[model samples]
Target: MTVGTIRPGGRTARVRAAVLEAAADALVEGGFDRLDLADVARRAGAGKTTVYRRWGTAAGLVADLLADMAEQSSPRTDLGSLLEDLRANARLVQRTLTDPRQGALFRAVIVAAAGDARAAEALHRFYAVRIAEWSSCVDDAVARGELPGGTDGAEVIRAVSAPLYYRLMISKEPIDEAAADRAAEAATAAARAGVFVRSAGAVE
Candidate 1:
């Protein structure tokens, strides 16, 4: 089997896994601007025609890649407390952004989203899926009377991650454990203070 090929017993599945792995490698090595379908196919050891036929365009390939990532991402951690859950989420984000390969891949995808509408939409969807998954922890917190009755779980989750992303993408600061802990702490404090509560007339 080729690098990144999985023995899932299906040729199509193996091909897709290989292609997505190759795409990730290419993105890490050469940002989104240099992502070429033919090169990715070559690296994946898949036929160029097959890649083109399946993905159609670079944007399409990226969209699929994001989908795969969202599918494979870790499930939310339920630690019985909102603070602990937020901390877990923050640490996970920190670890991913601090990893050499994952950090590069995320940076490439983010850059791609800036110039490609499809990529942007895919990126948004990926985060939405993640947020939805983790938002359950916030819901649990509200049920436990740790937060306001109408606290926006998704918004709370986003608040825990936004600072970390800013450090990774904009401020160019270190996304270290300390930063992650601080983010979680701040978000938890805000949520406990009802900052994340939805207004009475707000859309659900």
Candidate 2:
């Protein structure tokens, strides 16, 4: 099997779970620069050879961790109204970014992506999965005539979370409920005004 693949209900699966947990702890403590396979093995009570043979490198472990995260992420909420759905989405992002462990883990991964190509790809894939999941909310809105027929669901979803992430990663501002609500409102207004609609001349 490929790296990070888990066998069903077996020692292999247990080992994978343990290793991923240890990896997350390591990231939370020291960021991606200090993620070591042997250390992860020791922390997980698994064999060093197993960890090395399976993950090969820190980036490989990060990639696998992101895959697991994508698999385990929550499904989007549908609240009938577009604004309400987007507010829910933004609030979820706010909660995750404000959580002690999840926030630190995300910071480590974001920092890792800054200089590591493999980590960058993994990060991109993770967000892509999340965005697609929430994009359905926008799709439902368009169908209900709450948004323009050609509104880009994915972009609207991105807009809703963009400010929240900026606060988490750039401005060092608080990711409070008010901030989340503002993000959702701005994105909703823009989307309703047809800002997110794809035009024939728009660049893909």
Candidate 3:
């Protein structure tokens, strides 16, 4: 079974929740550089040895935290209009990147992924899950004839949030409602223009 597949009972589940919460706090407070297993255990009120035995390493703990986050993430919106659904997704991304605690945590994780292989893989997995969930919106769009029949749902989904992420990670600009709306509009227009249509032999 996968690391997150097990359904621990009662105390075990509580302990895991507490530990993961502490780990997120640590990341938000000081980033990945200061994420220590012992410190997280202390913050969680769990035994250091238990934390060490369960998670083994800071990177391992971070990976599990990301897995848990993926599980807890909100479901995709299903507004009938493709543009509306994309706008909802863009606004969700905008809100997350602009929120105080969530923004800090995301920045810390993103920074960690930049320098650590495990963190990078975990980050990729997280985005992959999110993209899959939101791709349904594009699928719906294709069914509604809003986009080309061969439109790549995943690509359309990625286009919606890519600009918001760029602002959060690269441009250091403000991620506001306007930015989110613009991103949604741009992606919707491109999708309508068949920009995300899958070509023959395209690796999906």
* Model 1 residue 55 distance off true place after TM-score fit, in angstroms: 0.2
What is candidate 1's TM-score against the reference?
A: 0.96
Best by lDDT: 1
- Residue-level lDDT tens digits of model 1 in 76-160: 9999999999999999999999888888889999999999999999999999999999999999999998998999999999999
Model 1, residue 8: what's the lDDT? 66
Ranking of models by lDDT: 1, 2, 3
Q: Every model's Cα RMSD, please?
A: 2.3, 3.3, 3.4
Clashing residue pairs for model 2 = none
Model 2: CA > 4 A from native: 1-8, 201-204
The positional error of residue 148 in candidate 1, measured at the CA in angstroms, is: 1.0
Q: Which ten residues in a row have the lowest lDDT in candidate 3?
A: 1-10
lDDT of each: 0.92, 0.91, 0.90
Lowest summed-lDDT stretch of 10 residues in model 2?
Answer: 1-10
TM-score of each model, paired residue for residue: 0.96, 0.94, 0.94
By TM-score rank, best first, the candidates go 1, 3, 2
lDDT of 3: 0.90
Query: Which of 1 and 2 is the better model by lDDT?
Result: 1
